[model samples]
Target: MAAMKKKSVKKKSVNKKTASKSPCKQKLSVSISHDHKLGHDPLAWLSGEEIQSLSKINDTVDPMTFKETKIENEKIHVPGIEAEKNIDQPVALEEMTKDIDDVKASETGSLPGDEDKTQRTNEDDDMLILPEIFGIAQAEDMHGELSSLLAVSGDIEIDASTIETLDASALQLLIAFIKECKSSGRNVIWKKSSAKIDSAASLLNIGTLLEL
Candidate 1:
């Protein structure tokens, strides 16, 4: 019986040791603080003036307005960039050639026209009444009439008082006709002049060319 009691005590002691050696399970918890208490400012490292400047910048720079301003600046800059690109072409050569042609035409007294003034006639002097609206639309008909008239003899009378809407194309045709007349030694008299013709000629810097 004593031996059985000692064995029961030993079993109890082993049970206590096994219980102490077993792993323990525990739960952990984490907490986050979001309160901005006094003397705990996130921007505490920044100076007062720096903070004020930053606030001013934030107030002045609106996201939408800044985006709009950037767009407007791009709009303005794009045209200038395109203009610069266009100006980089060989325009100087074309302009120089045109100037040389004009100078030669002026010096020779045989200005550039549609046709060479070779056809001559001994018919009586003619009078032509210009149409009211002389523009690009009427250029073809006017050119035909002027070419036919170039063959007429004596002084040609041109009544320009009826012209109302005269454009560059009409002015060009008239210039060609006048140059043809001058080269052929035929006189061209402007019986009546219109303000539109004079203004257009002056605007195009072809007043001398048209003998306005």
Candidate 2:
């Protein structure tokens, strides 16, 4: 009985040591808060290079990490914050590329209604109406409505009072249109939430936009 008790005590100590030495042991603590945007149409927001870079990063960033952590929770906080670090990639490159494209488009007088193969219109020649405000700032409004429409059905009208008319079908169609346009490299105007896009749609020179 004495020998058995000694062996039992030894086994308990070994188990405790093994538990304490678990590979999952973490010592340091740091975190960051992010108001994450999920289900983003990455193609719309990311340049070809950025997309490629992200894909490489994704390949390297263990897929399990993404599954385990929500996008907002994945933000890393480095210790010893002597200075605040900004986004790694500068906005300049994307802005420059967009400017160059706009210049080239101007030189060629590219109309808003330009057709690309991936566009969602049933007709081959359907064109998007380009708005005056340029840059990524406009994209927020555009993607928000686009995302909302995709989420549920409501009265989906391109009218001045359209949101009230949106239904599930309309939202689905709108999402499809946005995706198609994005995939086709078509220019888009993300309207502001309170911007009365339906009114703008009415104001748009539809006659002039239509290609005869």
Candidate 3:
């Protein structure tokens, strides 16, 4: 009987220790009713605010059309050039013809009042210029003009080239000549490679660049 009492005392002590640990451990109270079905509150699940929609659903999102940006004309400026204009922009055919006429007259050292049909006036970016104004000349004549411009402009002179053929003296002279040609409002360009020539040209002083 005494042993039984001691065993009962030990069990009570263990129960007390377990009761003390009840607050630290998770204790759940389940009210098992006659119904064995699961209880669920659909409203409590998420009122559409608590749950975040799953991203990367691979569902096609509506395509978005961005507004087209307006292309602004960029004016290129060269040192010693008074006209600031966008030279790359399209020019009027009639104006270009007139420019050619004027250029012919200037080359002949004709008086400004004495107009020559052999040259025409070319207008680019609101700037007026003259190119040789002959009406649809032969291929040889056109090639001649191109060659003349190349020779006069000294395009063969490459300042930045690694080859010995191109040097600073010749490039400077070419730059000076091209600068004069552009100042005359003549839209002559290097014939070999437009890109290569333009890259070297940008190094020259034309004038203040005007962007329309």
The top-ranked prediction according to TM-score is 1
Worst-scoring 10-residue span by lDDT in model 3: 1-10
In model 1, pairs of residues that clash are none
Tell me each candidate's TM-score. 0.41, 0.18, 0.18
lDDT of 1 by residue, 25-48 (tens): 211111111121121233533453
CA lDDT, every prediction? 0.55, 0.33, 0.32
Lowest lDDT 10-residue stretch of candidate 1: 1-10
Question: Better model by lDDT, 1 or 2?
Answer: 1
lDDT of 3 by residue, 55-83 (tens): 22222111122222234445655546946
Query: For each predicted model, how many residue pairs clash, with residues at least 3 apart or on different chains?
Result: 0, 12, 29
The Cα RMSD of model 2 versus the native structure comes to 22.0
Tens-digit per-residue lDDT, 97-134, candidate 2: 55544553343342232232122222312223333442
* Model 3 per-residue lDDT at 100: 52
Give stretches of model 3 more than 4 Å off. Answer: 1-164, 194-212
